[model samples]
Target: MNLVFLYGPPAAGKYTIGRELASLTGLALFHNHLVVDSVAAVFPFGTPAFRRLREQFWMDVFEAACAEDRSLIFTFQPEGSVAPDFADRVRQMVTKAGGTILFVYLTLSHEEQVQRVANADRGKFGKLRSVDLLQSLQADFEACERAMPPPDLTIDTGTTEPSESAHRICALMRDHGLAR
Candidate 1:
């Protein structure tokens, strides 16, 4: 199995681009927000219940993805400092499934991310709880380079057209023999 993990700050368009890439490449897309959004509807943000549900959902998804004999695209925003154990769990899961995992980190200008989140139409999965929170989290994500490995590919979509960014990702995947 092939798994592409797309991660970035909120409203960096990981979901938007992940969905489009799934359509174009015939890969299943399990975006980070999809699960969180679903659970957020009922639970208050930052509650222990919400965190538990989120952890369960991601663990299940990773397990399921491991079982499948197909390629997939998953978006994530792992609080870099949360815990190393969780990341280790993900690595072990993928390794056991005989799957290879690739990381794709997308970054854009702060102004652009804020605009996207602020202007976004809230979906059924819920929405960003606070703009200030998103900003702080992103700043933290950026401050620590050791938090996450250098991505397999880093694309800055703030200046490029959305489609162009998608093309760039697909190109990298193809070049690396991760996609058709």
Candidate 2:
């Protein structure tokens, strides 16, 4: 299984672009919020139970998908709130399963991200909608990025349409031996 890991800050279009990328590549889309929202629904966010369940779900899915050789496109927002070793753990699992992980970092200007965060579609997925919250999160972006694996491909979403970005990602995956 090969993983297309889309790493970016919120409102940088990770999920939006992941959908397009999945459509183009035929890979399953697993946005971070899928587990987050489900767990948050049962336990309060940030509580120990919430964190533990969220991590368990992520690990289970990754393990199952890798063992089955199911390639996936996963949307992620790297925040300091999570365990620092989470990314490394995911990488190790994929590699142990003889899979390649392509890290695609998406970014946009702060002004653009702030504007995009307020879109009504975000609320449907329980996305952050406050400009103040965005600002606080973005303030830690550089620090969060420092801990991530260097991106195999980087795209500035502020200037690129989702389809175009997806096209670029697909091309990268093809070059890296993923046919689609």
With a 3 Å backbone cut-off (N, CA, C), the pairs that clash in candidate 1 are 37-125
Off by over 4 Å in 1: 80-85, 122-124, 136-138, 141-146
**Candidate 2 local lDDT, 26-62, one digit each (tens):** 8899999999999999998888999889889988999
lDDT of 1 by residue, 1-180 (tens): 777878777677787788778877888898777887777788966688887888898888788767876668888775653443665577678868887777788888878877777754644345564678786677566654346655888888787665777788888888878777
Number of the predicted model whose TM-score against the real structure is largest: 2
Name the top lDDT candidate: 2
Candidate 2 wrong stretches, greater than 4 Å: none
Local distance difference test, per candidate?
0.74, 0.90
Question: TM-score of every model?
Answer: 0.83, 0.96
